[model samples]
Target: MTLTRRDRLVVDARAIVALGGPLLGNNLSITGMAFADTVMAGQLGAVDLGGLAIGAASFNLFMFLGFGLLMATSPSVAHAFGANDARKVTAYARQSWWLVLGLAVLLFTGMRQADWFLPAIGISEDVLPVAVGYVHAISWGMPALLAYFSLRYTSEGLGRTKPIMFTGFLGLTVNVIGNWIFMYGKLGAPALGAVGCGVATAISLWLMFFALLLHVRTHRAYRPFDFFARIDPPNWPVLAELTRIGAPIAGSILAEGGLFVAAALMMGGMGAVTAAGHQIALNYAAFMFMVPLAISSATTIHVGHTLGRGDVAGARDVGWIGIGMCAIVMTISAIVILLCNDQIAALYTRDVPVRELAATLLLMAALFQFSDGVQVGAAGALRGFKDTTIPMALCVFSYWVVGFTFAYYFGVYRGEGPVLVWIGLNVGLTISAVLLVARYQLVTKTRLGAAVQRPI
Candidate 1:
């Protein structure tokens, strides 16, 4: 019995939601940790808040690179699971552990060197020390965080998102409590200020990793795969395969995230007020971004599953559906941002200048929400088809070549201020949306057409 188009849409939408809902919860919990950090840091004054902004932006840029590389586990494992190739699924999971561990070491080493170059980036003397300490504090947990990503992406591929969500909430709880203790000098601890936030976040990451590890090890649903039953030695071929797929993903993430981090770094020279304001606006925008990001993850899974089952047409449809949903959701988010930008800014700090500047930047954030949503959605869909190289190029060109160049020229050289910087953001995101969506259309058509021509 052929399902009507409406029926198909309904079924696919339900599946996307069923998968995305828990992922959404997880993503929100993850974002909540950062929100807690920002609000708490704001209370300490502009210098502390400004320091955190630069430190976090730098840390997150690197962190996302690691996460992006490990993300390949999702599609790879999803494909195997969809085809009922349980052995292949387990194999991929085990091999990913090795890859993540190596990345953890490299990232940890890199993070520890923040002191060496942060001042070179124009971070003010007062802010530089704070930023470097915060980064170094957080660097301690890199191993645990990367290990958790290896397990998290494996679970995501298996469509077991509840555990991930649960762990995320647990981490958020731990983070808040830890922040209270460390930042306030409670329980015989000296006040650490912004550095305290780093300590708490790092501790939470370790706890989250262990909690997820225990759950994955003991859960009956994961028993068949026996992920921990036997330790598999490093498999170079498997590592290479994951790397091939993930390297482009890492590049794409870095390109886009790098632009934002660069903007923050650039703001450093303007003064603490501007830096703090930018952080508030950027933080809120990032928190809102998790919605479409979670949906994009689900879309990748659904499309990968459809393709694995040899339903090329279904995969294409799933991609488009996900992209449309993201656009609609972000449109609503933009409305909310516009209507409450002042109130939202108030949530971060009480300083009048910071509040006013933040509210202004929120306007720009609202302007780009739709483009941000659409581009991420399209990128997610393309990953499902394992067509990452071209998307990487598109992102780099859009984010760095078009986005960064315009931002530096108009906002810095022209001395136009943060609004123009955000205009550059909007311009880049819009181009990325256009290019990536076009790429998706082309890839789906070519792949689907080829599939149709194959002999029975």
Candidate 2:
């Protein structure tokens, strides 16, 4: 935490340079889609927006697993490449695909059964139809979405993120066009209204998937292994390794995703206005989270590579550099929120009450950025070490036991409103961040000491 001590973390500048740009770029584009999705949905009507929020919150719970499982792809690939094991990389990639796809089928089925899902989540009667429609329509995108995550993770594992950046841009464009065409009946399409948002999401997903596939086809780094080439037979031992590393990662995301899903369910019990306001805040947070989330990807790759090269100090450097970069990025973004909190809220709505509620909610979100940023960075550090299981247990206690408990008491029980709930949310994230940092510091020091004593 000291200035000079922090300065000592500069051992891996080239690795930082290699990672920082692509991860930040990818995060920004992904954030744009998140922003656009909420803005577009909110613009439709309060009812529609509330429904979209509910549906998305529910889906995110499962998506945490689907996405986390993709983590199985990257670190192993990085480790394999670092060890000069080309065969291992191919083997891990192929198995990671199968692992994530099985998860996707489960998710697709669950979404198809989302009608029962609504009532379980305590969705209000009037908003039920909109929520149901969004869930079902968006359900169709799950397979494409999983495919995209798998491919992207594969690329990142190989120390390539720029291809995904190109695809992300393509996704953003496709999303905007689809939203315009389907939402308002532009381009000779019928005005599908709120449901159109779901359609737009589906189309954007496919566009991103195919665009990346095309890139991989022609890019020299990826060209040697034609899809037609006989890939390594699926390796169960490798699958086991991936699962061991990723299950906890999945659990951690599930816990965090539960925050939104649980909030929506509780808000639905309250009213549409509350649900809509929650969505606005959540949409914004999701955008910001991409920074640390993307950094986690880089941390995993960089750390695995360093470890493979038997450079313990260098691996530690990658983790610290990632942490520093995330702090800077998130802190700068946080300033924008603190200063113009009200202005940003108003953009979400013309309704005075919704605007007021959103602005007040932003206050709860403001200072919490530091905690959220650091916690995500710590999580990234763990991923770099291929450590997920302990974090998963930590998340369960922090998020479900402490986080949801506080949210219920502060937001629901107190009826002291969203501000209290938001404050509680911050408390939960901060706690998680602190614990994760402490654990990582101890572990990193141990690794560094052992490396120093070894006969190099």
Candidate 3:
């Protein structure tokens, strides 16, 4: 029953699409919540939108660290599942809960104290109160958010992505409703404006977490994993192992996310109009990025599974296909952004200056879509191979050393504007794409060579 190369390619494509489809939906849903928050907050006023941007940037800094740590569960679980090591899979899943608890507490404390550092970062007086309120409200959800990540990553590793998709939509629905109710002070609740957006987001996180927990508890498909069959205490060695693998991942994610956070903070100092405009452009770019992000996630799972089955060639093929898919899709997205820049900008706000600035930035955003997609795809492939430390170093070099230096020169020192800042982002993403793709190639070639030389 040996299949032809064409048949195998078709099968690989099908597998990637099957895994990526729901992941795409899930990613989009999550980003949609952010999009909603931005749009709703924008309606309140430019100052409110600026505050949302700063608060969200700060929140995401801590959140990405927790997310990267929890993400260790995915590749570990995928490798175990592919190797048919059910005990190992359950062990990794259980240990992730411990990691989640630790991260939740740490992030919660940091988020609560976020306001103390706002003035140091140059957040304006008018925006500071709103940003503080937003962070404080959202801080309550750190536990739920980390818990959801642990469960979601475990499910993703098992190739059960539909639950994530379903829960994501459910979360989005709840977020919108909560925002309407709380932000506008519907039904006797006091109107809290931008702060209410954080409240809504926090509530949605808890809802999603509990929903996934209930599903894992009762679903027959998850019965074998025994996610709830026994209570396991914290295991330091296993926790350490997870952290060892995850720390570099966290660093890499922080490097990329930090670049954006820095840009947001820099824009904050520029003024409310500039900051609001930047948020609009960045939010749309993030929305479009979900497509490639989902492809990247699927690539990691596919590559890990293939490697676990001792198929190095198959893993390499999957990686390339995933990267190719991302490139092609992003090219199309870039075209769309170029074509509808004004129309898209108009969707976010009515302020003439903000709209004009955002529209201009969207043009620059189009230029970087391909680079963004390629780098994320390559990073995902590397993760599947359990090679992260080098990638982390590469990201830090690309983003901070190369990207920020240029951004500061053009945007801040020169006082050019948000457009020049986006140019820096494009440069960073392009450099990351080149280096990360090369790294993936080198890693795969070495692995393939080793696999061939081994005695069979």
Which number leads on lDDT? 1
| C-alpha positional error of residue 406 in candidate 3 after TM-score superposition, expressed in Å | 0.9
All candidates' TM-scores? 0.99, 0.94, 0.99
lDDT agreement with native, every candidate: 0.92, 0.78, 0.91
Please give the lDDT score for candidate 1.
0.92
Q: Residue 366 CA error for candidate 1 (Å)? A: 0.6
Backbone clash count for every predicted candidate, in the order shown: 0, 0, 0
Pairs clashing within candidate 2: none
Where does candidate 3 stray beyond 4 Å? none
What does candidate 1's lDDT look like per residue over 81-102, in tens digits?
8888889899999999988888
Q: Give me the runs in candidate 2 sitting further than 4 Å from their true place.
A: 1-11, 224-228, 453-456
Q: Taking the tens digit of each residue's C-alpha lDDT, what string does model 3 give over 1-456?
A: 998877887898789899999999989999999999999998999899999999999999999899998888888888888898899889999999889878988999999997698888888777888888999999998899999999998998888899999999999999999899888999899899989999999999999999999998899988898878786998888788788878999999999999999999999998888889999999999999999999999988888888878899888888888999999999999999999999999999999999999999999999999999999999988988888899999999999999998998999999997888999999999999999999999999999999999998
Residue pair clashes in candidate 1: none
Worst 10-residue lDDT window for candidate 1 reads 120-129
Q: Give the per-residue Cα lDDT of candidate 1 at 131.
A: 91
